[model samples]
Target: MSTLHLQQLPLPDAEVYFIPHFIPAPESDVYFGRLVQEVNWQQESIKLFGRQLPMPRLTAWYGDKSYTYSGLENKPQPWLPVLQELREKVEQASGQKYNSVLLNLYRTGQDSMGWHADDELELGQQPSIASLSFGGERRFAFKHRTRKDLKPAPLILSHGSLLLMQGPTQHHWLHHVPKTARAVQPRINLTFRYVRG
Candidate 1:
């Protein structure tokens, strides 16, 4: 078995664990491949202080209903069949029902996400975030807020996998997708969340 295959073997969950080609072989490519073409990706600009700065990456959101977004107002896209199937699978595993998912498409190695917790009001207190990844691999880093010197570890999220961040992860730690020099392919991430009405 390959190293990646070995890593996929059930293990105790780390702060992060590599799912390693977690998607079933038959349907993996089709689901995400279609998603790549279907999502209406947009580069959004955020007002920082007095200046409007374009975010480093492109993003989109999908769900059962309309959602209020910061900087951009979005209307819900009708749920696709593949997404509905995936949602059911994720719900079975995580035991959480997510009404919406926020997608981030990293177009190049230069695109990245900044450090922040997912502690938004819509998520409710201590909400569980079930993040599904596909396409090129990227390094996801997490660091404890109070331990400056602690070595932040990297988790290479592979195609067709899920990572669950639960409990106080949002309250105590910050996570980010750092820029890389590696020649990376496009990646799509679906962070399934339950937004409170």
Candidate 2:
């Protein structure tokens, strides 16, 4: 946390900060390997247009409360030591308490997340989310929900990077990780948040 140089992204109607090297490369490598092996990653299926299809990536949920996302309820799983350690580091940098984390494993460049906002009711109003990225770099972008004049903001989430989105960001903007055809290494992303019981 002491090494973080948090920089606020210059975007209207949102509170977003990015730290490219929240953790050093050596530490990140160790954490990344631990996460890939320790966390119980699962390939889930989503309902789309009345058909059940496998999600593009693997996912895992852990922490204090159950979460419902993408029309599915994810029951909480016991936190692993690695997760707890990472959580503490992230909490220090973000200066916010988080009781839960949602992890995604993009096994290939084709795995991706669609456009969406983290404005769930359980998150309450103006929720703060601390996103931690590991492994391969990926392109991330945000777009205003109803503004035509504003251009979409794009960013590259590098290994060991941290992205914090809070305040009116979820209400005003939607973000996504688009699929790429280019070959790339696997990636893992963790989004830490507090879920009100």
Candidate 3:
């Protein structure tokens, strides 16, 4: 049985919720671990300033529409059985039909996601993002883009847990996966989105 709740966290004028430990697939975790290994992940490069910096984290995108994306442009891989199954679970929980998902694999403690908001033109206005974490527990941080006075808060993302970013969350805040010094394990995060393209 999966236990989930919508708890509002302390934030500014905006609203945000923390859905701790939502994904209830302990057995499926192992299945996804093997799947992540078998899949062919390409190491892509990103342009920072005038120079190119190769992203440490591996990424893949899967969706219904054929649209170009910014940052690390990854070719959408055919959805595997496990991925498809996960998609259904997320869709039901969010009560929203998502046509696309961006998968990120953090191979080691060195791998990290930089500070960025998911506010994109393709995502339409006020987009809602559902992120599911599996494999390893890591610190996920969020900070207000304009409110520098607000301290950056950390949320421990565990295996089989889901974090949903909705309302004006992406518009007012920016989130990222920070690198840890402790012995870290591999983690796979799936951010489901509804792209109107």
lDDT of 1 by residue, 54-109 (tens): 98888887797555655566577767776788888778767678998888989899
Candidate 3 clashing pairs, residues 3+ apart or interchain: none
The numbered model that scores best in TM-score is: 2
Error of 2 at 188 (Å): 0.3
lDDT string for model 3 (83-110, tens) is 7887888777777678888888899998
Model 2: residues >4 Å from true position, as ranges?
1-3
Clashing residue pairs found in predicted model 1:
none
**Candidate 2, number of clashes:** 0
Q: Give model 1 RMSD, 1 decimal.
A: 4.5
Per-prediction TM-score to the true structure, in the order listed: 0.84, 0.98, 0.89
Output the number of the lDDT-best candidate. Answer: 2
Tens-digit lDDT track of model 2 for 1-197? 34469999998999999999998999999999999999999999999999999999999999999999989999999999999999999999988999999999999999999999999999989999999999999999999999999998999999999999989999999999999998888999999999997
- Model 3 lDDT at residue 112: 91
Least lDDT summed over 10 consecutive residues: which range in candidate 2? 1-10
lDDT of 3: 0.78
Report lDDT per candidate: 0.75, 0.95, 0.78
